[model samples]
Target: MRGVSLIILVIFFCGASSATAQFYQTTTAHVSFYSSAPVEDIEAVSTEGISVINADNGTISFKVKMRSFQFEKGLMQEHFNENYVESEIYPHATFKGEFLEKIDLQITGSQENTIKGTFTVHGVSKEREIPVILNVLDGGQRINLSANFQVACEAHKIKIPKILWKNIAEIIEVNVNADFQFISK
Candidate 1:
């Protein structure tokens, strides 16, 4: 009888451990972009991006509005919307992807993982794989993810005016850091 009871207890604990692996989602996530050039590069920043992450299923969807972008100077901001990004037509960029592998919440602290998803920008969609570091906290109830990746302007059909070609780099680096709270459904 004692051995049987111990086996049942172990099974119960294992089942509970599996059930505790839950994920969260957030729309107020933050994202930013940066470009580098010799002396004329244009650098901008935006924090009004939205993101939804499901840690349990390893799915992520996010979007950012071009109009929310802010540049170092007013003139640059205007030019970015009018000439480069065409904010009036292609107003937003988005991404939908899932983590390549399941993140074990039991490990706690921070762990690096690969995220595989399709990124849409300037009306173009392309598959991309990025490395992300996830910080699991609050007994796996809260999550913070951070990653940096680069995208070529031409891949998204973003054309640079011949006159300002020297003012922007062909490739732009994007940085993402998002905090999410578990959503009970």
Candidate 2:
């Protein structure tokens, strides 16, 4: 009877360890965006983005502070926060979604996949399907993800003044690169 109880305990411990490995997260994900207008190009980047992924369920989430983005010119940043996105009112942008295909955590190397989810910006949420490249590195201890997508200013309620319309594009190109580490739940 003692031997049977010991076996059950070991199995329980093994199961628990594996379950904990399914969670991966990071707080320093890099996010950038660019807008090409007829007159000038606008760009900004934020390295304070936070993200998480559930390997067992293919669920993913990301949150980026609107005020954290840094632009080349201070005036550009000010205009972005005060007039465009209204960062004081809508402080953060978020994305929550799931991978359309199964992701094997044990797999090494890169895989192309699509994620479908809601992307909220400037207080507006829109459904988006983003294509991503997942690179599993260090024997699954780390995962690097890269994706490029476009967001429409009008769709997100970000208003570009007619006077400066030539300085801002209607559609913005966004890029994300995140490195996540496996964490125990």
Candidate 3:
């Protein structure tokens, strides 16, 4: 009976350890922003973003260097780093949030969900709930996420010159996409 008890205990411990949460992470996530006004259209893309998701708890977080964004015109990029986002002062923009509903991402396919969290830009943080689309691929070994949201310049104290106000939109459309492979511990 003692041997039987020891065997059951070993199985329980092994199962408990194996049931721990798993996470997926990627450093090459893509993030982009677009602003279209009557006078001008502006857009920038950044591939130097890092994203992580917990397959167990549905928690997600993303971070990107402000200077990593690239614009078609050099001047535009310079202006964005110096005058608007002030990359020198606040180097990175980050988002941290948790899923509102429970779902298993290990199953391959697409699922829509909402997440509530805080987004920090220009050193200011705002709580927002965003809708997201998750795509599972590679039979649960890979995952992709996409989210669309809007950010208001005024909300973060981003100042735009009066002359260029019309050239830039007060609200910017932000889009994010990230691909990740499951990391086993």
| TM-score per candidate, chains pooled | 0.83, 0.88, 0.87
Give the whole-model CA lDDT for all candidates, comma-separated: 0.74, 0.84, 0.82
Report the lDDT tens digits of candidate 1 across residue range 41-149: 6667777666656556666766778888888899989988988788898888877788888887777799989888788888889999999999988887788889899
True-structure RMSD, every candidate:
11.5, 9.4, 10.1
User: After aligning candidate 2 to the native by TM-score, how far in Å is the CA of 154 from where it should be?
Assistant: 0.4
Q: Can you give the lDDT of residue 123 in candidate 2?
A: 96
Candidate 2 segments whose C-alpha is farther than 4 A from its true place: 1-21
Per-residue lDDT tens digits for candidate 3, residues 1-185, read: 32343233233322332456666777788999999998989999999787667767767777788999999999999999999999999998987788898657556799898988889999999999999998889887888889999999999999988999888999999999989878754
Error of 2 at 121 (Å): 0.5
Question: Candidate 1: what lDDT?
Answer: 0.74
Give, for candidate 3, the lowest lDDT window spanning 10 residues: 8-17
Write model 2 residue lDDT over 66-85, tens digit each, in one string: 99999999999999999999
As a TM-score, model 2 comes out at 0.88
Sort by TM-score, top down from the best: 2, 3, 1
